[model samples]
Each structure stands twice: as structure tokens, then as C-alpha cells.
Target: MAQGENGSIHENTGERSPAGQEAAQDTSLAPRRRKPWFLLVALVLVAAIVVLIARKPKDTQSSATAGPQIATIKAATAHLGDIGYYVDALGTVTPVATVNLYSQVNGTVTDVHYTEGQMVHRGDPLIDIDPRPYEAQLEEAEGTLQHDRSVLAQAEMDLARYEKAVTLQAIAQQTYDDQKLAVEQYRGTVRNDIGQVQAAQVQLSYCHLTSPINGRIGLRLIDRGNTVFSGASNPLVIITQLQPVTVVFDVAEDNLGQVRDQILHRKALPVDAFDRSQETKLASGKLLTLDNQIDTSTGTVRFRAQFDNNDLTLYPNQFVNARLLVKTLKNAVLVPSAAVQRNGTQAFVYVVTGNTVKIQAVTELTTEGDVSAVTGIDAGTVVPVTGFDKLQSGSTVTIQSMQAFDSGQQRLERTQDKSGSTL
Candidate 1:
């Protein structure tokens, strides 16, 4: 046992041992060593945090100084003009009249008078059936008629003689009565014979087929030398009137009121027909009529237009894009259709003032081809027609070309001034 100043015991090397003193000294030194390490680590962590915090503002400032962005766009100037607002619809060209000519008599086809696709006038003979049989029948009917008439005349003469003889009592009364009956019978026979003659003549006329209307004939369904019967299933030929054609189309029912007004006013609304691509004008016509009823399933109404196709520009069964000139709006603010943008139900246009753009709400009245009529913006206002994706309110824009806007405005003003002076 060793006694220490703190009155503790040590079992090893039993002298007043130095172990406790050394352990006490070590324990005091351990805290001093750990304090520097902890302070160094803490100082390093604090310095890193301070450095990160100090750099944040400079990074943000550097980003802020990168400069404002600008977008390039194409712009067009709105102009006042006479914009023809039209109702567009799909249509089909049809002939005014189509006639399928059929043989009306049982006879061999004797002649094809018209060529295929030949234009013919009314009463122009198109086909001829063998007339020999019909002619013979007519002759037979005429002979029977002549024979009955002669017998009737003879019986009437005999009846007159018998009546005179009965009065003189030179002949039996029965014979006179018989003679009167014979005369009446012969007259009835003669009337029947006359009917037969007329019927035969009608059949004979049918053997020679003529065009019922002025038209272009289609292909010959039956060739010459082919036997054609009355009421045959196939027609001898088809004739379609082509000089004046018609177009039938369907229009949205919503526009029915305006169309009916035009009709009631007796306004000859013009209808222009174009090819399927709607690029070329095929023909010009007048709106003929509107159907009696609307088609419930399609929400549309059918309309007919008549075209004087003197140049044969319209062909039957051809598909066309029809534009009915419902009305014309004068002094309308028209712009390129591309300039308009829609956000939900709101339509807007971006008008460029100097280098910046501002939003202008517009009501799109009508769109015709590449141009649109809009309200809420004045004519001659410059609006961007393209590159709208990069645009926002107050966005800076570099115009690729300003010539269109400038020139258009100038031209429009000059025209209006000239028109006003002329008026």
C-alpha cells in the first residue's frame, strides 16, 4: 500500500509511487491537447461557411449583369380596306339537268346519230331503232281502219235503203232492223281501228329517239345493231346539260339567318368556286336557293348555286371549295391572320411600339385566306405577325423587316385619299 497526498493506495512497486501523480498530470494534459484540435476544426468550418456566404452575392450580381434578352419577329401593319367576308363550304358541281334516254320500242338499233360526249340541242336525233316493224304495224292499222270505214259506209247506205223499203212494205221489218245493227257494229269497229292507228303511230315515233333537252350526251350504252326493248333496264345514252351548271353545298346552320335575309331581299349573292386547294377560281355563280329544311344530324343546311358555265369551266361531279360572298365590310381593319393569338377564350395581338411590344385584345370578326378582320385595334397599327412564342408584355423585339408595315400604311392612306377625292 502506498499513501498518496489524496490518501489513495497503489499496489505495484510499493513505495510512495509516482503513478498517481503521472496519471493526474496526463489527465490534465489530455484536455489541453483536445482543445486546440477542436478549436482548429471549428475555425476551419467557420471560415468555409463565411467564404460560401461571401461568394453568393457576387455570383448573383454576375448573373444580373448578363444583359437583357431580345427577340426577333416579323411584323405587319393593319390596314383599312374592303374585306369581302365570305361563308366557306364544300360543294359538288352538278349539271342542271341529266336525262337517261332509254329505248321505248322493241326493235334493233339502226343508227347512233351522235358521237360520244357530243353536245346536242333539243330534238337532235341521238339514236334510231329499226323502224321497219313499227312502220308495218302502222300500215296494217291504217288498212284495217280504211276497210272498217268502207264497211261502215256500206252498212249505213244499206240501213237507209232498208228503212225506206220497210216504210214501203217491200222488205221485212226484221231485215231493216238487222241492217241498222250491222251499221252500228261497223262504226264501232271503225273507231277501234282508228285508235289502233294512233297507237301504232306513237310507237313508230318512239323508234326515232331525240334529245329531250339541250345537253352533252354521255357514252352510248347500246351500240347500233343491238336489240333494245321497251322499258329496258339500261339506257341508250345519258344527256347532261352543261352550258349552265349548278353547285350544291352544305353550310353551317348558324349562318342560316343571314342567308335567308339575302334570299328574302332578293339579293343576288355571288358565289365563287375554287379548286380543292382553294387556290384557283374555277367559276363564279349566283346563289340559287337554300334547302327547305336543315339537316339535323350534321348541323348544316344545303344550298344550291347556279353558274353560267359558258366556258365549261365547271364539270359535273367535280369537288370544289365554295365561298359565298355573304357581304362585304368596308373600311375594315384587316391584318395578317398569323398575328392573332388565342389564350383560352381570349384573343390577343401584340402591337409593337418602338422596340417593345404590348398586348392588344382584339375581336376576330372574320378570317379570309391569310387575312383577318379584327376590332379593338385601329388600322395602320403595327402588329407582329410571326415569332410569337418568345413574346410577352413589354418584351423587346428586333424587327427583321419594318418595310411591310411602313409601306402598307403609306399605300393604304394614299389609296383612301385618292378614293375620297374621286368621290
Candidate 2:
């Protein structure tokens, strides 16, 4: 054992101790080894963090210097116009008069004068029955009437003679009175015969059937040589008037008062008839009359309108849609119906005032199609018609497309109409 330079005791033997060898190895290896890069990496990171923090404030200040973003939207203007109030109802086209021709006398049909579905005038001969039977009966009645008239003349001559005889007192008064009474009885028989002759003539005329009115005749029911009886259950033919046609429609009882007032004032309400789809207009007419009572089951009243169907556009029992122009609104303020938004039953519009839009509550009078007649805003007020997604009470909007809003509202009604969740 030997003393080392410091105070530690070390063995100086050729085979050194394990602790001494480890200490010498550490001292020699300390200078030759590489230095760590951790400190340099840590300083570079600190500089990068400082640069990021310094740039973030400048970007934030620039964003804060700029004003709020203004949104782009579409807008429309309100205008004044005349809006018509119309009532629509399903209807059926009907003829004013339909005549069903039946046989009045029993006879074999001799001739059919009119063709099937032909237009016939009043008094036009239509069918002919076997008149020989009725003609012979009429002749027999006339012969009997002539014979009774001759007997009455002879009795009257005899009564004159009897009157002269009674005045002169040449014959008994009882005998003259008997002759006068016989002459009076013959006169009564002659008067009865005259009535019989007139009745027989009427029976003969019935054999020739004539059209009672001018109209389009239907198909023939009975052919020639067919025997027809009197008072048939079915008609021989039907004739319907086509020139003046009518349409029957039902109106709701709730609207009865408005309709009744217009009718009582003698105002002819114009009615337009459309096809089954209620698209193509078939004809135009005026309201003729209405039923005195309403139908209790349907809560509606029947109304009839008459049209001059010169083109034969209207037919009996044809289905149609009738629209009646009840009244007209004059100088009504109107806007696009889309502009009107509803929150439940409350209707509102976004009225643009200068750069910002304010929520404006409005009263909707009526809506016809795409336009609405509103009361809250003025006629020239501007409103945003689209872009309701981000709209609020005070939304700044840029109008991209401005339109002249026309008035015609329908679905969005007189009450509250047309709503959305986005307001």
C-alpha cells in the first residue's frame, strides 16, 4: 500500500484494484469524450417561441382594425296594386232545360223524321205514328157530330111550330110543352157531340210528334214500325238546350254573407270555369242565382251561373272548377310572399333601412299566388326576399339583386301564412 497525491490510499501493485482502475479510466476519458448538444437545442427552441409570440399580436391587431363583415342578400320592394278576391270551388256544368220526349198516344211508329243527335228547331216534326187508326176515329166523331147537329136543327124547327101552335091555342098546351122539352134535349145532345169532335181532333194530332223547343236532340230510342204505348216509363228521345248553359257549384257557408250581399245588390259576379284540373279555362259567365237554403250536411250552398255557350264548350254534367271573383282590393300594398316569414301565428318581414335590416311585423290581408298584400309596411319599403339563414333583428345586408315585387298571394292566407324555422 502507498499514499496517493490526495488523501486516498491506493495499491501500487502491477495488478491494480478495481476501484483504482475505474477512477483512472474516468479521468482519462473525460477530455477525449464529445460534449452534449442539449443546451444548444434548448436555446434554439426558446428563440423560436419568442418570434411566434411577437408575430401573433400584430396579426391580432390587424384583424381587430378591420370592421365586421357585411352579408350579401337579395331584396325586393313593395308596391301598390289592385288585388282580386276570388273563391274557388268544384262545379258541374249543366243545361238550363232538358226535355225528355215520351209517347202520348199508343200507336205503331210509321216514320222517324229527325236523325239521331240532330239539332232541331221548335215545332219541327220528329216522329210519325200510324195515323190511320186515329184518323178513322176522328172521322167517325165528326160524322156523329154532323148527325146530331141535323137532328138539333129539325127539333128547333118543330119547337118553333109548337110555340106558334100554343100561342094560337089550336093544340093542347101539354102537347106543345112536350115538343118544346124534346127540342131542348136534342140541343143538349148536339152540344155534347161538338165537345167529342174536338177531343177526337186532339187525339189525331198526337200521332205526329213535334219538337217542343229548339235544342240538340239525342239518339233515337224507338225505330220505325215499332209500336209505342202511351205514358212510357222511358223517353223516346232527349233534347237539351246548348246555347244558354249553366254551371252549379257549392260555396262554403262561412262565405255566405259576402256572396249574399253582392247578389242582393244586383251585382253580376263574374265566374270563370276551368277544366277538371282547374288549369285550362273553359268558359266565362255571370252568377245567375243561388239556392235559398244551405245544405246542412255539407255546410255549403249551391250557386248557379249562366253562360252563353256559342261554341258548345259546355256540356251537361261536365266536371269543372269554378272561380268566382267576389271583390277587388284597391291600392293594396304588396310584396313577394317569400319575404313574409311567420313565427307561429305572428307574421313578419325584414325591412331594410339604409345599411341594416330591422324586423318588421306585418298584417297579411291576402295571398293569391307568389305575392302578398300586407298592411304594416309602406308601399315603397324595401325588404330582403331571400337569405334568411343568418338574418336577425339587426342584420347588416348587401342587396345583390333588387326586384320590383308584384302583388298576388294565395296559399299564405289572409290570416297567418308561410313560416320557416330559420326566421
Candidate 3:
């Protein structure tokens, strides 16, 4: 029985050892069950890829969806009417009628009918000379004229009587002849007295000085108490007509033929006068006349333009810039001056094509204000105005709506306001 118990114990111990050994084997295999370095590395790489994908630049994919980055202008058809070829020149404003007021007779100035710088009409009395002496002279002239008239009547009657006496021989022939001679002498004397009287009367009428033309009187050189004389070198006052004024300017000889042709064809050429600043237009007028001949020394021609100065804004001797409209052109192509780009003396423009910009050479004809007349660029072509500094031929542009572009930002804001207002 003891031997049996020993065998049972050995079996039990062996069973326990097998179970423990199995547990030990399981524990050792647990360390060996860990994943390989390559598998871990693959899992880490997959995780890194996912994170990188999530952190990638979002704008890159949506960049193409962003609208064009260029500013554009819609080309419109325009009727180019009367494109004038103008000649620019300097000019001076002058009065159409200028006169120097003077006294016609020697006398003391008694009354001044007009104030300084006063507007006077034609035949208006401006200066009234002392009339007392003139009145006495007129009275004396009248009496002398009356006496001459009575003497002339008596001489005619005597001549008729002498002719009758000579024909009838009622008196001595010598006596009749002497009587006729006496009548002739009396007639000559009477005619002389009449002329003297008329002269005196004309001298009396010259006491009053009147305006020769309708004009504005300048400052009076002679006061009311001053003495003035007829045919004096200096005038009593100077007067100028400001209502109808004249502007005189010079044009080159080359343009003379054009001006003359325009005058003959159109009857009148249009002229515009601007002040010194060239910003303010003073008046518009028609070409009235030209000098008889061109100035040989300067190879230029002088011209005069007449303006109706109803407003009286133009003053005499004021300098001005003048433009003469010689002719006009029709169906002209014009673009903004800013759209033209210059490379040396060659002129070019940026034209918008399908997904690209092109640089095209153009011929510039003339410029008026901010617009230029050009050829080669059609009216429908889109010419760049603002981005010329950053643009080149064939450059891709993000075409932005001109209405939506902000010049300050040089960009277009895409977001609408919270109020749903389009910016």
C-alpha cells in the first residue's frame, strides 16, 4: 500500500509539472507573440499618412474654383462724330471797337456827363465844354449870316437893275457897267461873311464832346475843370466796346491752307479760347478774318476770331490759349489713354483672348483729353487699363469683373455681406 501511495504522488507531481510547464511555455510564447518591427512600422506609417491627409492645404484643391483675377471692360459701339483736327496757339483778347474820346473844340470842360468806366451809347454826350463863349460866338455867327443874306439879296436886285439899265440905255453906259461891277463885289463880300458865320457856328457846335461808338468809357484823363483843345495828341478818355470782342492768334504756315479751305468750304471755322490754366473755357467764337499775308519771318499767319461778349467775361489784352477746329473725322476708333502701353517709340496694348492676354502693336493717331484715337485695335477687343505694370504677353490672368474690382486692394472680394448685399 505504501508503494502504491508513492506512485500516486509521483503521478500527481508529474501532472502538476506538466501543467506548470505548459503554463511556463504559454508565458514564454506570450513575449514571442509580439508583432514584428516591420508590421509596427507599417501601422505607424498608415497613421502618419491619415494625419498628413487631414492637415494638407485645403486651398490647393479649391484654387481652381476661384474666379478670374483680371479686370475687364465691356467694349461698346460708339459713334465718333466730328473728330476735329485742332491747332493750338496763344492769343490775346481785344475789343472790336476802341476809340479815344477827345474834344473837338478848344474850351474849358464844364460838365462830365459820364462817370469813369461807364457804358455809353453812340452819339451820347460824354464831356460838356464851357458853352458861354460858344453860345456868344453862335449868336454872332447868326447875326452875321442874317446880315450877309440881306446884302446878297440887295446885290442880286442891283445886278438885275444894272442889266435892265444897260439894255434900255436909260442911264450912262459906264455908269451901268460900274454898277454891275459894284454888285459883283458886294456878292463876293456877302459870300465871305456867310462862310465866316458858318465856320463860327461849326466851332460852337464842337463845344460838346460825344461818344463816337457804343462802348465803356475808361478813366477820365481831363477833369471837369480842365481845359481841352481840338486835335490834341492825348484823349480826354478812352472807350472800348466789350459786347463784341475779338481774339487774335497765330497759326503756322503749314496750317494756313487747311484753315483757308475750311473757311471757304464751311463759311466759318470754330474757335475755342481757354484761360491760362487751360481748364476753364472763356468763350467760343467764329473765325472772322485773317491777316492779308503770312508773317515771312516766323512762317506763321495771324487770325482774328469774333466772340459775342454778352457776358463781358473777356477782358482786353488778356492772354488765352486758343484751339482752331480745322476739320473733323468720322468713324474713328478711340480708347482710353491709360490702355496704351509704350515700348520706346512703339505703342502697344494688352488684348484679352481666351484664357490669355496678348500684346498687340497699334498706331496712335491723335489724343483728346484722356482718350486716344488708334488703329489696329478693334472696338470689341478688351484692352487692359490698370494691370499693365504687372502684365506680360501671354500671361494668364484671373479675370475679375471690373464692377467688382477694388482699385485700392487690386483684388476682388468674393464674400457677400451678411445682409446678402453684393459688394
Candidate 4:
């Protein structure tokens, strides 16, 4: 230690003055500045390592599932079952018997016996067309009939007397013959009078209108006090048989042979009718009959089905869709229709064996809804339905149900979204 001239403390150097001290100080500060930069570089490297560690599991999982190395797909199994073959066509609801009822007698409508939209039975009175006139006519006919009957009795008595007298020769032969002829003439006249009386009775009965069948009656055209005539242009009311109705539909010519064979064999083919949207079943019925000839314009044939519409689910002239079950492939190889893939002229399916898939060629026999009957594949064969775009023969796969696959995909997307937000 040395004392300065003004008694200030001073650090002793061996051979450097204040300028040399400043140079030494500068050299010592250089190492300190360089150490901070080295620490910064080390911190950057540590951050990079931490990030890699955090993302390691995610990368492993994503790599395992994201690519086509092991495709996740929806799958199903082929099994032995019965699949229906159906023919679908638009149909119309029709009533078995519809009648536009009109008055049969020329008279005023004195009383209406039925309300609009009424249910009627056979022989139920529907209207009274001035029955007072009918009563008079019936009375006249009865009187005439009684009088003719009396005349016929008298003629028969006279004929007996003429026969007896001719046999005994009590009168001239010519005179007896004339009497016999006159009696015969009177008997014939009586018979004709009786016929006329009956005709009048029938005409009188026509004044009272009655239902001829059991059915539902539509709107009434003739009201009380309205006059109506026989064979009028417009009907008084409409009646339709509803309890046992029918549906008529058209079937394509392609299916005519099978349907005709079934009909010939007297097999009752079932038919189901649906609404316009085909989302609801309206009625069920059996095949009634088919048209005798095909319609050349549409290459189709008409079919009629009968339904016991106890519930009245169908109406006349209403449109519907019909499904006819043609046949069933019993104990056949059945698979999901979605599993069948087409490549140009070839149909194939992805048959899953263990963790890999192999393309199996198949022939689709028929499809009903979501199920199909196919050939060239045995029962209980596992097959893949979805994730086919990235698949090929001998490709590895992870079997999953449609729900599971969708859930996994959702989770992966969520993970990716989280990662992006963090960045």
C-alpha cells in the first residue's frame, strides 16, 4: 500500500500508471460481457430441449395415427342372414267400391235421411223423395193387383164350366170353344194387368232412396225440398267402401316375371304402403291381382293390393309409395351395403385379417336398405367400410367402429387446435 499526495487511497501496480490501469480494467470487463452472451446461448438450447420433451408423446401419437401406416376405419362383419329383395314404386290408394248415388225416381226431396259424410249400411234409408206420391202409386197398384186377381179367378171358373159343358155336349161346340177362347183371353189380360201393377209397385218403391252397400258417404248434393230426377247428371251423394279398401301401384317390367310367377303359384306377396315422403307406413296388404297386359309407354304393369282398412288409414285417390317384398336370400352372406366398393366393372370389399386388409372381389346379389346379399365371400368375414380412400391391398389397418373412429378424429383435431393456440 502507498499513500497518494492528497492522502487518497490508491491501488499499487507493479509497473503500470493510471492509463495502464484503464487498459487493464477494459480487459477484465471483456470476459464479463462474453460470459453473459454464453449464458444466453445456453438458455436458448435449454428452451429447445424442453419444447421437444413436451411434444414427444404428441408426436409419437400423431405419427402413429395421422398417416396411412395404420389406417383407422369403420368395419363390419359378414354373416349368414336373410336379406329381403324389394321392388319400390309409387302407388295410389283406391277404394274397392265407389258409387255416385242418384235418385231413381222423379220427385221432390221431401226429407233427407242422411247427413253429409255419414256412414251407411246396406238398405239404410238415405232420402225420402215425396213418399206421399209413392204411397198413392203403391195403393193404386195394390188395388189394380187385387182387381186383376179377382178377374183371373172368374175366368178360371168360366173356363171350368166351358170344359164341363163341351165334354157333356150340353152346348154347341163352336159356342163352347168361343167361351174357352174368351176365358183364355181374360186370363191373359189379368196376367198382363198383374204385371202392370207390379211395375207400378217397383216404380213406387224407387221414390225412397236406400244405400245399396256398407260404406262411407261423401257430401250430399240434394237437400230437403230439392227436386231430383232419375239419371241426373250430378249425383246426390258419393259412397265409398272403406273398411276393405285397395291400393293400386305400378311395377316395372323387369320384375313382372317374378311377380307373375308368384301370382301363378298363388303365393300372397306382401305389400307395404308409405306416405309421400316414404317415412311412414300407412297400410299393409297382400297382392290382389295384376293387370292382364303391360303398359307399353312406361314398360310397366299395374298391380292391385287389398287392405283391410279397419283404421281407415287410406283414402281414395291418395298417393303413396309401395314396397313389395319379392324374395329373401336365406342363409346367405350378408354385409353392409357401404362396404361394397366399385372400381369400373369390378366390385370389391376390404377383408380384414388381423391388422391388415386384403381386397376381396364380390358379386352383389341384391340390396335392401342398408344391407346387401353378396357372393364370393363366406360368412363371418370381417370387412372395412370406411377409410377406403387411403387403403390398398396388403395395407395395415386399425379396426374401429364408426363412432370410435369419429371420436378419435375429433380428439386429434382438438389436439392440433390446442397446439396452434399455444404457438
lDDT string for model 1 (31-58, tens) is 7898999999999999999999999999
TM-score between model 3 and native: 0.70
Off by over 4 Å in 3: 1-82, 172-185, 230-232, 341-348, 355-363, 391-423
C-alpha root-mean-square deviation, each candidate: 8.1, 10.4, 16.4, 13.9
Per-residue alpha-carbon lDDT of candidate 2 for residues 106-187, written as tens digits (9 for 90 to 100): 9999999988889899999988988898889889989998998899899889889888988999889998888889888988
Q: How close is candidate 4 to the true structure, as a TM-score?
A: 0.75
| lDDT of candidate model 2 versus the reference | 0.84
For candidate 4, lDDT tens digit of each residue in 195-300?
A: 8778777887777778888999897787888888888889887888898988899999999998888778888998877789876667777889889999999999
The 10-residue segment with the lowest total lDDT in model 4: 403-412
Best candidate (score: lDDT):
1
Lowest-lDDT window of 10 residues in candidate 2? 414-423
Greater-TM-score candidate between 1 and 2: 1
User: On residues 204-313, what C-alpha lDDT tens digit does candidate 3 reach at each position?
Assistant: 77787788888898986887789888889998889899989999999999989878887778678878778898766777778999999989999999999988877777
Q: In order, what lDDT does every prediction score? A: 0.86, 0.84, 0.75, 0.80
Candidate 2 shows a clash count of 7
Q: What's model 1's overall lDDT?
A: 0.86
Clashing pairs in 1: none
